[model samples]
Target: MLSFNSVSSRVLQTLNSTFNFTATRHACKITSIHAITSMKTQPNQVNHSVELGNRRKCLLDRPGLFGIKRGMITWFNDNGRQFPATVIEIDSVEVIKHKTEQEFGYTSVMVGAVDKLKNVNNLKLFEQAGVSPKHKLGEFRVRSETGLVPVGAELKADMFAVGQMVDIKGITKGKGFAGVMKRHGFKGLAATHGVSKAHRKQGATGGNQDPGRVLPGKKMAGRMGGRSSTEMNLEVLHADGDAGILVVKGCIPGPNKAYVKITDSVKLYGKSIESIERD
Candidate 1:
């Protein structure tokens, strides 16, 4: 008699072969075996699972690109809490041109925002954008190298949807020269009893013995703000395609008239929120 282990191994092998043969025969019956064979030989053909998985991953890693504008904050209001403000409008963005991998070593679309004829003296750039003139032009990189996105392709608030999260990137408001207490948030010396002029000072920067020199990033008093920053997970309150306006909830960096770039949020808490535009 055959050994028990060998018999079990053979049984498993036979079962696997039988299952595969049954599946192949069933598929062939549904569609002729010629069709199956053709699909197998086709170039760039992939299984449904593989195709679906790749699509899913692409959806998850949605590209976030930058945009620029020179518009005022229109309006804002506090909702009574740590989070304040509702709605911001960054208007019409027209696609000027696209950069290809051959020329730029990457694919990206160049968009023009906030028209200002006085500053934009380049008449050719205006002619290309199909607009009078623009104060700012921005470029955003995408995943693929699909030719120019079509000159004059208008982008509006409709590109994003309400209830979806987004990442807002902008330069923070500049705060000129500042003290350590205001800039680096250092707890200065006590205000009472012999504290003297050292009240706002950064105190002992380094110890006497060890290390001998001050640390590189010692957080001393200096210029503050005016740096690129990102505010994540800001909810889009509304999108008006006709008006080319986007209403985003929560505060954004920068002053009233500062420019900012908005993109789909990299991280989201709930299930992937599909936009109505996709449907």
Candidate 2:
């Protein structure tokens, strides 16, 4: 009979040999499988879904909402019946100050327009604003509070780009007291037949018995024009960076040289350059 120690050593060697044989067979099987898969896969049919998904995610994660405020418009000339204008340049608009809910009980950005000359009565105001000598100064209220925009931070026409639509706010040209024929689009009396001073007069304001007085808010002609108006979706034609001018296509709300507030357009169709490009 074999000794106990010799028997144990023989058993261990046998186990090692069986393990090595099984491992070698498994390795050969794995290698063959890999070669078959490589041969089956076509180079031109490589999967790109992962890369495409990453790119889509990157675009969706873009930060911040970029848009302009309302009440701004661009101006241009009308050739025949067609209007043509472009937005060129807008001055550097800076946030001089802000109003917080805790202090002023509201959130607003105090945007200063052109500065004005100092007046003796408004000495303190001039000192507070620290604005240079200018002809006019106005404050524009923003919808929400923004980051701290330091004084002297000038805004440029590039804030807006070509093909953008803006809303313009201005006082309409005054027509004083106008007649019904001119103001309310009344047909007026017959030109030739029995017609006298009653030509432009409002025909019949009220009935005989039902209502004695003329109804309130009736479209009678008293005064026309000279009121605040907002024109929307004026296309930005060109932007002159150095000159700080924005040439827009078509007529704006106010007369030439009149002060107007230019803001982002409220109309859904008119907004950014991308939207215009699509149209």
Candidate 3:
């Protein structure tokens, strides 16, 4: 007569061989023959869990990379939750210069990205920095000189990690001579209350003979967008240093292929609340 423990082990091994369990299902439970047979199996292997590394937190500001907006994509989390992300392509970024507080009254690093083969007017600038001519240049201010990277150092997308928050600055799409309703979200005049040809007007300008002259900062129509704007506290969804791609959650300013400045979030600094794995 076989012992109860031996019979149960035989039954479990037979079940494991017959059924096709997914890695996730097997990891969540005990489906492996070794895991069921051996008492010395590592707990982590039996129940696989992805732990986020806290490597993004920093004490001071650091230089950021310049990237081109490649467009948007959808991402799925480990739990199958969906999220919208904007993909930014990071070119070959190199440190071009360093601005010390003694020389420039502030500590900063100048980085250039997107190599330019020809028509580089400032060849001496690249020569002095010992770097290739780049199409785009950006300056990043740091709290101190310690944050300055050596000149000619190449920066990559891995400077930022998944779950790290960042701030992106870009020029918004230009809308020439927009109306107040479109530009400032004005309610405008009612369509049917005997308001002829002025349905979309800004309604009124100012008071009558009292502190008038159409107040300097009135919400009237003018050239809309096409100005520098910053989106803050956007979480990083993915970063591929080898592929030179950086993806962030939600939409950013400007149209596709437009250059944007990326930096650590001023509000959150370099602290990351959580991390996500690339699918």
Candidate 4:
């Protein structure tokens, strides 16, 4: 006697054999086999439920190696919240030269300013890099040995899109010689204590004979800003190719008209709010 349980098991096994169930780390694909079946079963097909496997992140999901180009400072306002941002005119970042690991010890692309250089800080460096003279120059490494953009290819603001994060590198505005309070954000001396005109002076920066005189890097009055700085994970507010502008949210290093470099944020790229927790 064919019991109902046994009959059902046989039917399931037959159906399983008919349909090819291929499972992978990314997805489950079920390919149906062409087989004649009863009209009732055909119309009322039993749907097989699959608890999908975890999908692996693909190469496309990962942000690729990026390039650097000079940008200018601009302002962006969102809902009355005005923000000073650095806007790069990335309409065209001509690839001046390509360096190889075999010949140059490392792979990199030397890029020059958009137009003829009005002021060049390092003419010898540009000459060695085999690029035309420009106001400024930068190098970005390539991921693969053959990852090279054509020498004359023009890179636009489109390289970085709105909502994407980037690291803005530039020279911070020079404040000249400044007090410790302003330079290192040191709180001024006690308002009512024995402190006199030394209110803004960095307190007691001396060490014992073991360490010798005031520490080499004592936080005393010194030059502030005017140094290379990198603002990381700055979100892109907008990007315009025609205007050659890229608006980033929040402030970046450098004063108005100062040259800046924009590149993919190392820690923030290809990350979502839920996946990323950063201060």
The lDDT leader among the candidates is 3
Winner by lDDT between candidate 4 and candidate 2 = 4
In model 4, pairs of residues that clash are 71-88
Question: Candidate 1 residues 150-180, lDDT tens each?
Answer: 7777777777877788888889989999999
Ranking by lDDT: 3, 1, 4, 2
**Ten-residue stretch with the least lDDT total in model 2:** 58-67
1 against 3, candidate with superior TM-score: 3
Q: lDDT (CA) for every model shown?
A: 0.65, 0.55, 0.83, 0.62
lDDT of 4 at 188: 76
Q: lDDT score, residue 194, model 3?
A: 95
- What lDDT tens digits, residue by residue, belong to model 2 across residues 1-279? 999978866765665576432234323222344344344554684345533332222121101111222233534434644454533224444445555545764444455444554553444454565754334345543333443345545556555567887767778889989989899898977666777768678788887888877889988889899999977787777665566676666666666556666655655322333333466
Best by TM-score: 3
Give the distance in Å from residue 187's predicted Cα in candidate 2 to where it truly belongs: 1.8
Model 1, residue 11: what's the lDDT? Answer: 61
Off by more than 4 A, model 2 = 1-82, 86-93, 118-121, 269-279
Residue pairs whose backbone atoms clash in candidate 3: none
Off by over 4 Å in 1: 1-83, 146-148, 268-279
Q: How far is candidate 1 from the true structure (C-alpha RMSD, Å)?
A: 14.3
RMSD of each: 14.3, 20.1, 22.6, 18.1
- Model 2 local distance difference test score: 0.55
